[model samples]
Target chain A: MSTQIEQQETETEADEETEPEVESPGERRRAQRDERQAIEEAQRETEEASLDDENTITLKVFRYDPEVEGKQEPRFDDFRVPFHKGMTVLDALIYARDHYDSSLTFRHSCRQAVCGSDALFVNGKQRLGCKTQMSELDDPVRIEPLPHQEVVKDLVVDMEHFYDQMEAVEPYFDADETPDDKLEEQRQTRENREKVKMSTRCIWCGACMSSCNIAAGDNEYLGPAAINKAYRFAMDEREGENRKQERLRIIEQEHGVWRCQTQFSCTEVCPKDIPLTEHIQELKREAVKNNLKFW
Target chain B: MAQHYSSFDRGGRRWLFQRLTAVFLIGVLAFHFMLLHFVNHAADLTFLGTQARMSQVSYFATMWLFLVTATFHGVNGVYNALVNQGLTGSRKNAVKYLLGIAGLLLVVQGTRVSLAMTTLV
Candidate 1:
């Protein structure tokens, strides 16, 4: 009899808790319609805003930050940016950084292609961000850091090694003698300057180095950029025969021009369109020709 | 930049040799292939036919040169490939010695085989 009385008490408590609070169906429908209308109106406003200025472009940007807890895991963030005629990938990145996420990190100084600071893997090809047109790329353009490079952050690679390799070639012009007259410059023939004109256009972008399979495999290999740097001075008649011979000796090391397998990847990806393979091949021939003279 | 101590320290000699041997091999290999497969039927080969070609001093000398060049080219190509893959230090030395031995053995054994074929005449 005590157990039965406890069960009755529990039932009475359950009934009190289950009491209904009701609304009319018409009122609920009107509220739902209002919410839908508000969402549509907002969508319309966004579309009008987009139409007011320009068409929208989708950019899938690679993101990673070891310091931030949320960004520790690498992910791609999509940003819908306004597209203008002749707009470049760098411009889109800037727009996204300024309007969407201020924390987006990338290295770009001069908007012009001269800086070589913005070499990126866009659409599976190495290209300068400031030079690649948005219209030329397919929709939802994929942009990532250069391949075969250690990414310090989003779209930024550690260029220390590349700079080191370039320096290893002693890229500056070294001459044994100054002009006899203080006011006069060292003379170079028109043909010689034209020969090295493309080679001299290297902005130290590291694009050709990054694109080289040999450079990726052999750390010691003087990459196309560095070898081309050597070529610039080695071929210049103004540097004299001794300096040219020294330059050739430096590049003819085991890890120098011989390491190049004629992959043409460096030439293919060079932003300046420098003929890296041709230069390397020419150096090989020159080295061979010089060695034959000794025999 | 590091200075090469000896006249041979620069890789120019080896690189030039590789190219020169490549050009020679291309011509010799093509000639050998055309002679064996196209000019003469490969299926009709006999011991006497082989001895007949080996008995000629020019043919025998060319075959000897071919054997030497082929060994050097193949061994050097492998060494270059290994170096390109970042082989260095003791590991590179090991590959160097091993390839050298292999090439020497190949040339020695190849010469013995060539002599045996000629002696049968």
Candidate 2:
């Protein structure tokens, strides 16, 4: 009885293997033709759907180059790019660069908003190109380098001054003590981490700095980004109270947190959604509190 | 690298003063406008009526304080705006002194005007 059952199972397996070869050549051809026709129909539907005028977007890109003869006089170049769902400003710019003109210049990397390289003045506001969705912007979207920074060349601003201000803040952790055990790491409370977490999100994209009217006016003003950087470390529990005092002193200068007018533009334009004015305001309070202790 | 611990570097005082003065001005200015425009009416204001209001010690004191605060706020605002525009060195110093003189003149003249009003009433 077991031999009979095994033989029946083997026969079924052989039938499955020979099933494909059993089909006639004419039937196989007809099946292949049906498959090709279905694929073509899908392709046709997609093409027809994308044929609408609304599916294209126009971009007015700022063009300038002191070295290049033609672009020496600043001008705007119009680029018409096909619109797709979930497309970003960075995608449109990349398409324009590749298909329209190879000489079009801009800085971008990691395309994921972490590198902070592609902050641009879009429609008169500071925005991250990669993070901003094209569908949200008006047609003929205007793209330009950040205002108040020296334009290096088309869509690229000289970031040296911004870097200098960021460096001036000493954007690093400096704790006075370490654990006795060599393997132990500094422990921070959940509340402390939560406090500084928003400030720590800053990617140094310079968007907040560019949006700030105070930063644009006062060259020496530490700017929102730097102050926020100071806030991240100053508010950390592991940094010790002494280090916090030192940080406060650095940010309480004439051109430091004092220069902020609570304009709220920095907070509004922050790509990371950091409450910059709040941070600066907090630092101001801390400085005053620290100063009053002398009395 | 050398840390300067000068008291003059304290911008917190000025920022606090700006906010404090703003709050005070909002109340006093509103009262002033209401008194002159709504309660008393500006068209019917006479020298005697003006004097009648100014002669009160509290009113006189408030007006004097208003004059001082307004001058400071205005001049300081202009100075800050200029500094934000990258004013530096001798130019900044020159603007500072000029604004200081202007503020002093405004306050002195304002006091004189108030005193004359009181005497006339």
Candidate 3:
């Protein structure tokens, strides 16, 4: 009985008003229905918005420094940032530091994602701080340094290891012959670039590398980010056929593609929407294919 | 060559068995609860009462089944959970073997208790 009454009320809310004069009965009825629907949707949206606005958020930022005395141990600092229209957690961090304390440190360059800095652990997930909007964050956003690496400073991890892994993959196109015209860029088919375009989109953010559990446990493991880098160059037809075997050999190393345990963490954290695990798995298939051919 | 063993990994299989054992244990637990709380006329529990039940073939089978399933489910599930939490290399292998031995000992000891109750041994 209560359910029927509730349903009736819901229906009444759907078709409550009509702004435009309707001469025909069918059009009048539609306008009335649309008005009701718009009113109901508006009411629902307002209710949802009020619920979200009522939620006051607090951010807990981890503080640590190798040089600072008296505070040898790592600790967390808490800040309450007021939520506003289209505000992001990165904006909140900036707000906190500028308004509250100058000592709070983080690395951010080219506030846009083109530079790829400001990746950090926001609520136990690796996310690009600049790109992640704040309203989406659950109350008490717990910010920490990216896991599975030596922290050089707050939110600034040593990228030398990541660079080494990327370099190890030989991330350069190796074509034996120079083009007839040295000035002209080499012609690549549209389809060829499309196949490996996603792999090339990696900005070396290191989020995928940090999220991987296997890479954390085993230091030598060529993390997902590196393997994807290799894929970008290797899969490019422009690199030529002569280098394919060498590229395969690079990925087939003991600490290479085989070490990935496929926990799906790398895929989840990638901001560029790069399918890191799929690329890694495809490389494994390629490596195995080469091995079978050799036999 | 290792064949792909269904979608269930070692951890997933253990999880499935843990749920299965829990279901089995519920029936056994009910029987146990009824025998102790309702069937037994006296309030006190004795070794003789256990022996009397174990002496029956049906009771012996039920007890042995319950004991084996419970130990395997409980111990293996624990080991699987540990492995999922990043246990690898020799340390992971060592825990695997240690837990194997512990599980074997428990099953043997538990089976003996059931045997002593029924004379089925």
TM-score of each candidate structure, all chains considered together = 0.83, 0.81, 0.59
TM-score of chain A of each: 0.82, 0.82, 0.79
Q: Encode model 3's per-residue lDDT on B1-121: one tens digit a residue.
A: 0121122211323443566799999899898878878888556778887787788888888888988887887787677555545565699789989998998999999977677677556
As for DockQ, the candidate ahead, 2 or 3, is 2
The C-alpha lDDT values of all candidates are: 0.85, 0.86, 0.76
Overall local distance difference test of candidate 2: 0.86
C-alpha positional error of residue B96 in candidate 1 after TM-score superposition, expressed in Å: 1.0
Please identify which of the two predictions, 1 or 2, would achieve the higher lDDT against the true structure. Answer: 2
Q: What tens-digit string does per-residue lDDT give for candidate 2 at B17-84?
A: 77789999999899999999999999999999898888998889899999999998889889877887
For every model in order, the fraction of real contacts preserved is 0.50, 0.50, 0.02
**lDDT value, candidate 1, whole model:** 0.85
Best by TM-score: 1
Superposed by TM-score, candidate 3 places the C-alpha of residue A159 at a distance from the truth, in angstroms, of 2.1
Interface C-alpha RMSD after superposing true interface residues, each candidate, one decimal: 3.0, 3.6, 11.5
Model 3 — interface RMS deviation? 11.5
The residue-level lDDT of candidate 3 at A78 comes to 85
Local accuracy of candidate 3 as per-residue lDDT tens digits, A59-103:
899888788874357888888666767777788888778656777
Error of 2 at A76 (Å): 1.9
Candidate 1, residues A12-122, lDDT tens digits: the string is: 554454335254767655655565555555654565465532488889999998888898888999988888899999999998897678999999999888989999999
